[model samples]
Target: MTLVPYAGSSAPASASVAELRPRPKSYVSRIWRHGPNDGVPLFRIDAAIDPATIEDRALSAALAPFAAQLQDLSIYVLHAEEVKPLAPWAVGRLDVDEKSAHVFLHDYLAAPNGMLMLNLFQAPGAVADIVMGVAPMVVEPRRIHFAITDYDIGIRASIG
Candidate 1:
């Protein structure tokens, strides 16, 4: 699925606000089921809140024990937006319908600052860091459509 970034103001408050409520009883929810092979136990971790909202000191403190305990696993303290599918399908959809693409750009550029996806992932810290890093990086939405059409048929065909 394409990662639909929630702009800071538009994002759900709970995802961005930490002091707004009491410390949640838990962050990690582990689910276990039988695996397809060998009947081995399969596990997945479902965290309730985004880690970027937590204060740095608190995050370090919480991670300390886990860091000590989990020696084998790589402790990749990455931002929530760090790993997501590229939104090539969005460009493809725009190419197929030029009028809709123009309308989309008109609507996006009507704002003081046009929105562009950050092409790279970031490390953990204040969630505002993500916004600040992307603020100066701007691209014309129409060019995005052109790049997809001119460069790659794979991208154009991926959507429709």
Candidate 2:
């Protein structure tokens, strides 16, 4: 799989923004929809986070259960401008579980500075519902302040 940017230039809002209204300032969530029918769910967390940080490991651990159930899991990193725009990088499909999730995270961690996008493909349920369960674990008290960037689920198949 390849990481595809959400094309909507304007900020799109969703129920998640309302639900997150009470939380601290950084818990912002951006929702984007792509695909002919907008059927896929791509969740992004934009934050001042270091991919190599230990907190990220915790997140992978949290998602271990879901990854096992999923046919494929991809984590993409888009470079966010603290000052200027930079190209984003993605670490494609990973084999995740309780034991190997930590290792897979390291590949993503190698990116210098970027937003995190977690894409779950071939999942069996509703997109919105799955994201609701995922949004909470993405936040941390001090390590990183996560902003949900987009929910657009458009991805390109990797060509060999």
Candidate 3:
């Protein structure tokens, strides 16, 4: 079964989900609850959101201007992922098309600013620090995020 994203503006409110997911009555009144102070769950560390509307070529097109303005540097694309065969039961008909929907996907790019941005939208705070700590800081990147919004045929990009 294909799991689509939670399509809504805000998350569902509390009371409305009584039938769907019940919360303990004491949840409201109790200050001290019964739970373990476990560390954060292991989620995808390197995650990214791609332009919702643009395709591969358009994605490149939108970034062309930025690329030109950039100081010709080699960008390293790092992918943190796991690969496994598609399960027949969950694969469904679309599985034959061979596209699995995912939330996080990103590519590294070199920019003219002499600073590497974690991504187009927002760069991880430590990226610059990591780069600077290495040694001879020769090239820096000016990262940018070009917004893409239409997925029907292609994507539309915007500079936020």
Candidate 4:
């Protein structure tokens, strides 16, 4: 799954915003399961947006329409993860193809900057069982409640 920041404005007169703006790169920084019954796989994705490349002026202008919402804008990290199968009877298999499913940033102007609309899109020809198995993790979290630290011992220790 690909995660991209939503450009607040519509298409430009000369060229599309996507064509002009460089796409931000994202990676799965961490993944873990929560609770029991095979648990829900939560993936923490870290994305880097270079302020130098992204035209803040253009973004600001586009966001001017929603001035009230942007009053106290705060930076936020977004992520996507795997969910359990929807079918009650479909059991035994627990493996999920993380590549086929993704939750992408859809809109940022509807409400406060903190309020995000994440949309889940699955790749074509992907297995239904796998997709169903991994659908909820991306769609469940209303807000991520986790602490961010300068250093990550969990990942480092595991890798070592």
Candidate 5:
């Protein structure tokens, strides 16, 4: 699976003028394969943003192509302050309505200085079982933690 960002240079209304401007940093794209001969390929794209900014529409546009292929979507707000409360809310929204979850995620991503990570999984069976098994932990305030780590590692190893 491949993720491609928008090629246009226009900035979203929420973004600052400086963010849309080009920078002098060198751009690099690399594909890395780990483990054995049949290892899964991991693609990493890094950019230097002077003042970290994320545009909601741009993110949504970039992900639109993969919407049909995705079986599960996980969004994490890495901000230390928000993670605690957001965990249960995320799980509840996901259980009730996935579209509403996406809407909330887009709004959160558009906020200034928002640190977020999104994981999209194509395989459903194993991942869905793993997610359901840990559904309780996702809602428990004291045990709020990402439940996909185990599934991610297992999938990578199995693919290899």
Candidate 6:
């Protein structure tokens, strides 16, 4: 499936912006409708993160679960100056879960300067809610910061 948004979609204040709010100071996250009028809306999360780890095997190392559940994957890298002027991504869905999508976001932030509009087309349910039920894990933190240059998300069917 493709992910994107129509015109006036980049305003960040549009009605569609609601799900993307409560965003991180340098990040944005939310969930929204993912189909035609009759389609179900899946949860979506976005973050502008560091691109350092991109091309490294480590990036894919932790993707086992995500890949098992992922229908597809796409990523974009934005330089510092292009953070704004981001166009809304036009995206479409196959069948997906929300939990997978949210967890994908959480993992995405762990990636080292990049902007990820992750569409985990699997409704895995709310992982956060379930995690809150369990004891938290302890691990060393590895923070990756992004320097966005420009951002945009518009849809286009797979060309393969």
User: TM-score of each candidate?
Assistant: 0.17, 0.18, 0.16, 0.23, 0.19, 0.20
Q: Of the pair 4 and 6, which is ahead by lDDT?
A: 6
- lDDT (Cα, tens digit) per residue for candidate 3, span 1-160: 2112222333333332111011111101112334686322122222222223223343333333343332222212223222221221111000000122121112112223212222322322222111100000111122322111111111123534
Q: Supply every candidate's count of residue pairs whose N, Cα or C atoms clash at under 3 angstroms.
A: 0, 3, 10, 0, 0, 37
Global lDDT of each model?
0.21, 0.27, 0.21, 0.24, 0.24, 0.25
Model 5 C-alpha lDDT per residue in residues 31-68, reported as the tens digit of each score: 34665674322222121212123243433333343343
- C-alpha lDDT of candidate 6 relative to the true structure: 0.25
Query: How much is the lDDT of residue 60 in candidate 4?
Result: 30
Candidate 5 Cα deviation (angstroms), residue 155: 4.6
Clashes of 2: 3
120-160 per-residue lDDT for model 1 (tens digits): 11213212111100110112322212111111100011222
Cα displacement (angstroms), candidate 5, residue 158, comes to 8.3
Better of 3 and 4 by TM-score: 4
Best-to-worst TM-score order: 4, 6, 5, 2, 1, 3
| Residue 7, candidate 5: alpha-carbon lDDT | 24
lDDT of 3: 0.21
Model 5 TM-score? 0.19
Tens-place lDDT digits, model 6, residues 1-160: 1122223323333322211111221223343456667432233433222213223333223222344233222222222232232222312111123222222222222234223333322223312111100011111122111111122332223333
Model 2, range 1-160, lDDT digits (tens) per residue? Answer: 2112233333324432311111111212344466677532223322221223323355444333444323222333332321121112212212233332210122322343212323332223313221211122122222211234332222233433
